[model samples]
Target: MTAPTPDTASLTSWVGDAVLAPSVHNAQPWLFRYERASGTLTLRADPARTMPHADPSGRGLHLGCGAALFNLRVAAADEGWEARVAARPDPADPALLARVSFVPGPDRDTLADLRPAVPRRHTSREPFGDEPVEEALLDGLRGAALAEGARLDFADDWRVRELLSALWDAGHAEELAPEVRAEIARWTAGVDDTATEGIPSYALGPRRYDGRAPVRDFPGAQRERDTAAVYESRPCLAVLGTHRDRPEDWLLAGQAMQRVLLQATLDGLSTSLSSQALEWPELRWLVRDPRSETAYPQIVIRVGYGPEIPATPRRPVDSVLTVE
Candidate 1:
């Protein structure tokens, strides 16, 4: 029996699922072009929305797009299509990130279990409980990252402390720089809930009472809050790295990140990202494992049970998706 070809309607649905993937500062810097006849979806970088200050080399942009690509693949599988992706297939068009071509494969069921986590996975900035993540679950997260051509390393007690210090130092540096603060301001929205993109002030989570958690300090504009909440004393931090630091490598790291995030969600874990230390070129080099500083650290993750986070906004599919 011949399998049915996916139409524009189905592709839109897949893109809808794909947009739910996380991006840095909610700066969803990606565009999707789907060709119905060839059943291929092309992912491109939205140059206009690139973060110049935080990600000068566009590493974060690629990572976030890579995450969206992973979601697209998972969504396609749920809709009964096998997605085969090729990175930067055309040299003439470097802006073209990846081209995912789909075909029918009965094995699509293998990833159907993860489809549920797509909606539930979020970046929770609040304090987490004392529950320790099991080694078995950590192993699954490593496997998930491996499946997408990236690495996830769990930081030891000492390493977590070092990372915390680095994050604190970097956050301080960011706070001091007017340009850096202004750069983030460009991507941060107020708590009014009118904007479709950027991190809203309400989703900033609770203010740090103990000053230990590695959450970013973007409370929108000049708003000041005296509110304070208890954060985890010893947070479980993990480093996501890639062997190469090229644009292509960043994209894979992003996919690996989302894969691990979804897996953690299924294991009943809440996750938040802390790339403050990784944003600065000087501090970013120190973020890797002391043993293997060669591995480029892409993002820092805080994992454990935490307060549920409200979903951040994303541009509608019609705005970011194009049909050909």
Candidate 2:
């Protein structure tokens, strides 16, 4: 007998969950097209949302789309469908990221377990408690990344210091670049409750007054009412990486990134991501620990206990998804 296929409504609902995936600056640079006839959902990169200055090579764009693809898989599993995904299905079409075909199947408990965290996982920019994360939980996070064919290494004290210094240098470089500043301003400008995308003022957290927090300073992110607080003195930082650096590797890293983040959320940890150093080619190399085997540092993750922050805005499903 032929397997059951997901309807348009089901696909649309899955896409709803998919958009919640984190992106660079919350740009959400992805598009989804669902074909009812074939029960397939196509993930595409939206060129219009590309950040030329900060992400000229489109690595960030691919990572964001990859994250959205991972969410779709989780959504499918939660809804009792198996999502058969093909990354870079079309060799000729660079914009086409992945194609997922859904069929009725038993729920994947592993992925369904993370569905609850989909909505709850937001970047916490506030100060995190000094309490250390348990070793067991940290091990689970490592497993989560490995399961997705990526590696997550917790930075040692010396490496953490080097990463912070690289970030400081990258941040200073970003401030001096007019084009990069303009891009930051474009996304963060006049963000309000009604806004569908970009980092809102309330979610930007306060400017760093006196801490080595690896938070990206969005232009004009702070308001007069906000006050800076001391972030965790010793942040629990991890480097998510892949063995090879390629478009496929980026997608894999992104899936691993979301899986790690969601698992952290379920483990009662506040999390934030920093790509400031990775945005700079030289600093990106500097941030990687020479002693470690993992290559191509994709993202720097901050994991600890902190206050829950509000979710960043996302474009409505209708705005980013199309059904046929």
Candidate 3:
């Protein structure tokens, strides 16, 4: 069924689709409020969803909400409406992440095609095929990030590889700390049916000893069996960054991330993200390209052709949306 045409109902439907956007550890850290009288949709971050230990400054929260905002825009376009978005419009209210107003515009089916991938796009932690991504497809993904005010840097040099590895080493070291481990444990719910969010045991991949590469192990604490198999080599790594390292910059990066991911989905690519390296302050600077000026790295996205993985579960729409 199509989304309702009335602004309120339409936005409600759009928000439902938007929530399907990925978040760190499936936190789903967002709230949507639709003003029927004004026809404005406001996206807010739920402070409770903030990962205080891993994401102390709420940067990841902004990224997650920003991804949801991007999906909302695409969903709006698919429904034949223009999404006029303002990121962090009010300085006084930090939680007011973005405001989207619907306007009549030319019909664009590009986003309509993306609608199908919204449900299909997933974080595939399994091994990808050795087949490299086409240069043209990579260009499309780059352009998608640029359009959202973010830059995509493909790591190809040995120095860059060393830097990323060093950062990952440092970040992983930090994660191993007793205090940090306790904090993460608090947020990460054990295999319980009542839990609505956080990474589940089923999503965890295997731990392989490949000195050249590393993958985040979600079920490391629970000793769950790894359902994912290993590929021959690591997939192409692309880092998303912004000129500035502010809250607004992070929001932009999040939107760009989802755009690139959805575009990858359209190109029949499987993807996963590795932000563990960028989570730590000391290691964050290491992830940035030395040649590129001071741009903060937001995420490390791994992309390549591979088998479609299972989608993660999300909370119901009624749980995240407020009608008033």
Candidate 4:
């Protein structure tokens, strides 16, 4: 496929669709610069958006940016152009994670189908109904993960519960660490409308003892003091994994995370993500099922039927996209 002619206007539209991707705390830790002369789009990480406490290594930030990158690929394909992508194209430029050159290719898929679910997918921290996700739907989710070079494992046994509990314990250990705790507090702006990034108060949901693995509450005392509506119970949980642990693997995992979430949204499923366990190195190892030797755990996703939470606000496209 030959590279497409540069079009500044069309590139801007593609960047707009790309930013609609979900990020941890809605940090949207990505910046795009498109060169009209070469039809190249550069993806860079915004260090300012990094979560110092919660994501010290910038793993979450990279993951968020990678998710946006995946969206960019889909968006370009939908625009009848093929995106030839290279991760970290320049060795000296650590911030520049990817460069995508547009080219002419078969326009078989429309990201417009995924577009509708872009805004529709929200982190449903609330509980889910007792019903199980259909096997076919689960398979579809697995396929979505594989397409991005990752794996998804569904946990449905007592042994899996034991492993999850251990990992959750390890995550709690990290949360208690002073440095990690400080970072989390710094990035987690309280439930206020004024804040641009971080988890919001309204989205926090109610805190109740469900006698099961629970989503981490970003809001500490403030959340406990407030009386919010009760969430459902017994939401389905799936673990996302990758075979190798590398920078590129992490990026691919992020893309798979967003793809699976968007697919779930399209399938009329509410989803939430818990990386607390995966955040702690000690706990991350425990999350890996003994049965799976080839794959390493990435993120834990909760899926089920639930109420449609309010959409989280995003920064304007002009702030993140630069056209030249």
TM-scores for candidates 1 onward, in order: 0.94, 0.97, 0.90, 0.91
> Per-residue lDDT for 256-297 in model 1, tens only?
999999999999999998888888998997789968533799
Off by over 4 Å in 1: 1-4, 189-191, 219-226, 292-294
lDDT (tens digit, per residue) of candidate 2 on 165-202: 99999989998998998898877867787888888888
Global local distance difference test of model 3: 0.77
Worst 10 residues of 3 by lDDT: 219-228
lDDT of each: 0.84, 0.87, 0.77, 0.75
Tens digit of lDDT per residue, candidate 4, span 1-324? 554565877778778777877787777788899887787889999878777666766677777887887777777777677777788788898888888887775847644467667667788766677677899999999999988888888877664575558656955686568776666655554646666566667776676556364567553424523654444444467888889876667778888998898899999998888777777676677777777644678788888887877866677788988988
Predict model 4's lDDT versus the native: 0.75
Q: Tell me the alpha-carbon RMSD of every candidate.
A: 2.1, 1.3, 3.3, 2.5
Which of the numbered candidates is closest to the native, going by highest lDDT? 2
Q: Global lDDT for candidate 1?
A: 0.84
Better of 2 and 3 by lDDT: 2
In candidate 2, residue 101 scores what lDDT? Answer: 87
On TM-score, the stronger of 1 and 3 is 1
- Per-residue alpha-carbon lDDT of candidate 3 for residues 1-324, written as tens digits (9 for 90 to 100): 433334666777888889988888888999888777667778888878877777888888888888888888888888888787898999999889988877775767466667877888998766677777899999999998988889888777564476557656865686577665665655454844455676665555555444234466542345256344556364588788899988888888999999999999988998888777777887777777777543788988888887766677788888888876
Candidate 2: lDDT over CA atoms?
0.87
Q: Which residue pairs show collisions in model 3? A: none
Runs off by more than 4 Å, candidate 4? 1-3, 110-112, 211-213, 219-221, 228-233
Clashes of 1: 0
The residue pairs found clashing in candidate 2 are none
